[model samples]
Target: MNKQTETLPDQWDAPARFLHWVSAIWVLGLMGLGLAMVNLVKASGLKFDLYQLHKSYGFLFGLVLIVRLTWKFIFHRRKISNRGFLHQAAIINHNLMLLLLLTLIASGYVVTCFSIIPIPIHVFGWNVPSLLSPDMLMEQGAISVHHMIAFALLALVLVHIGAALFHHFILKDKTLIRMLK
Candidate 1:
C-alpha cells in the first residue's frame, strides 16, 4: 500500500491537542472581548478597563503562541495524509490561520505601542511602557492595519471552524478527531 493509504496514528499528542484548544479558546474569547469593547461600551472608565483586559490577554496569547510554535518545532507533528483534496485544503487552511494570527498579533502590538494616547499596560500590577515613540501619523496607520488584519483573522477562524465541522460530520474523517482526542 502507498503512504497515503497507510494507517495513521490513533490520536495527536496530548500537548499538541492542548495547544490547539487553548489557542482556539483564547482567540475566540479575545474576539468577543474586542467586539464588546468597541460596540457595547462608551464610558471612558469602562473602555479603559476593557482595553486593559484586552492588552493583558493579548500579551498572554502571544506567550501561548510562542510556546505552541516552539512545541511544534521541538516535537514530532503528524503530517496531513495526502489522500485527497479535503486533506490538502485542511493543510492550506491551517497554514493560513497561523499566518493570519501572527499578523494580527504583530499589528496589535504596533497599535498599542504606537498609540497616540499613552496608556500603560498593567501586567500583574506592574506597568509596561509603550515600545514606540508617540506619533499621531504612525498611530493612525497602525490602527488601520490592526483593524484590517483583525477582520481577516476573524474570517480565517470561521473557515477553520467550518472545515473542522465538515471533516467531522460530512467527510467522517480522522482530521478533526486527530485534534480532539
Candidate 2:
C-alpha cells in the first residue's frame, strides 16, 4: 500500500494535524482580540483605532476559517474509531464547533458591513453590502444576534477545551494526542 493510504499509529495526517493546531491558535488569538475589543468599546474616549483593528482581525479570521473548512472537506484523512461514547461525543463536539465558527464569522461580517463607517475594505475585490443603511432596526437586530452567537461560541469553546483536557489528563486516553503530530 502507498504511504498516503498507510495510517500512522497515533498521529494524524500532516495536513489535518497542521490545520488542527493552526486553527486552534487562530481561535485563541481571536478570543483575545474579541475580549480586548469589547473592553475597548466599553471604555470610550480612547483615541486608539480599536474598531478598525477589530474589523481587520475579524476579516482575517473569517478568511482563515473559510480556508480551513475547505481544506477539511476536500482532503482525505484517516478516520479514528468512534465505537465508544467518548469518541462519538468528541466527533459531535468537533462538528458543532465547525458550525459555530461558521456562524460567528458570518454574523460578525454582517455586523461590520452594516457599520456607518465609510472605510473601504473589499474582500476578493468585491464590496460587501452593508446590512444596514437607513434601516437602524435591522442593524440593531443583527448586532444582537451577533453578540448572542459570539457568547454561545465562547461557551462551546470552553467546554471543548475542558473536555479535551479531561480526556488527556484524567481519562488518559489518546483522544487529544491522536491529533498531535
Candidate 3:
C-alpha cells in the first residue's frame, strides 16, 4: 500500500480516542452553556458569570486541542480502511472538522481581545491578558464569525456521529468499533 493509504491497525491509540471524546464533551458543553447564557439568563451578574466560565473553559479546551494535535503529529493513528470515495469523504470530513475547530478558537480569542469592555480570560485560575486593544467594530465582527463557526461545527459534529452510527449499524464494519476501542 502507498503511504497515504497504508493501514496501520484496526483501532485508534487509546490517547487519541481519549482526546477525541474530551473534545466532544467540551464542545457540546460549551455550546449548551453559550446558548443558555444568551437566551435563558436575565440577570446581568449571572450572564457575566456564565460568559466568564465559558471563556475560561474554552481557553482550556484550546490547550487540550493543541495537545491532541501534537500527539497526533508525534504518533501514527490507525487509518480507516481504504474504501475509495467513502474513505476520501471521511478524510475530508475529519480534516475539515479540525480546521473549523481551530478557526473557532482563533475567532473566540479575537472576540475577547477586541471586546469594548475588558474581558478577562482565565484558564484554571491563571489569568490570560488580551492580546489586542479594544475595538468594538472588530469585536462585533469576530462575534458574528464565532457564532457562524459554532453552528457549522455543531452540524459537522452531528454528521460525524451519524456517520459513525451508520458504519456500526449498516456497514457492519469495524470502523466505529475501532474508535470505541
Candidate 4:
C-alpha cells in the first residue's frame, strides 16, 4: 500500500489558516455589534444592556486576537508571494490591517475595564475590578479612543476585502485561495 504524503499547501499551516478565518469572522461580527451599540447609545434606551453586550464581544475579540497573533508567531508561514507591485502593497496593507485589528481589540478591552458598570467577570480566572466609574472623565476618554480604533479597524477591513477580491478576480491568482484553503 502506498502512503499518500498529503500536506497542507506551503502558504499557510492548518492552525494559521484556522486562526485567519476565525479572526475574520469574529472581526466582522464585532463590527456589526459595534455599529448596533452606537445606534443604541444614540437612542438613549437599552444603553446599559447594549453596552454590556458590546463589552462582552470586545473581550472575546481581544482573546481571539491574542490567540491569532500567538499562532502566527509560532507557525510563521510563508508570506503571500505575488510578483506585481500591487501584490507587494497588499502584503504591507495586510500587516497594517492586523495591527489595526489588534489595536481595536486592545483599546476596546481597556475601555471596558475602566467602565463604571461594575460587571463582575474574571479574566483567566483573575478578577478584574472596574477601574473607573461610568461618569469618570478618564473612562470617557478611553471610550473616545475605543470608538476611533473601531472606525479605523472597519476601514482597514474594507480595504483588505477589496484587495483580496481584486486579486481573486482581476489577477486570477491563487493568493486568496491559499488562505481560503
For lDDT, the strongest prediction is 3
Candidate 3 clash pair list? none
Reference-based TM-score of each model: 0.89, 0.77, 0.92, 0.77
Cand. 1 Cα-lDDT: 0.82
Q: Which pairs in model 1 have colliding backbones? A: none
Please give the CA lDDT of all the candidate structures: 0.82, 0.70, 0.87, 0.72
- Runs of candidate 2 with Cα error greater than 4 angstroms are 1-9, 40-48, 77-80, 120-134
**Relative to the unseen true structure, what is the C-alpha lDDT of residue 63 in candidate 2, on a scale of 0 to 100?**
80
What's the distance in Å from true for residue 13, model 1?
Answer: 1.3
Clashing residue pairs in candidate 2 (N, C-alpha, C atoms within 3 angstroms):
none
Rank candidates by lDDT, best first. Answer: 3, 1, 4, 2
**Native-referenced Cα lDDT, model 3:** 0.87
Clashes within 3 Å, all models in order: 0, 0, 0, 1
Candidate 1, TM-score vs. the true structure? 0.89
Question: Over the stretch 118-176, how does candidate 1's per-residue lDDT look in tens digits?
Answer: 78667788777777887888878987887787788888788888988997899798878
CA displacement after TM-score superposition, residue 158 of candidate 1 (Å) = 1.1
Per residue, candidate 2 scores C-alpha lDDT tens digits across 58-147 of: 677778877777787776545544457766776787788889888877877776666565653455566556654533565577778877
Report the number of the highest-TM-score candidate: 3
- Candidates 1 and 4 compared: the better one by lDDT is 1
Please give me the total number of clashing residue pairs in predicted model 1: 0
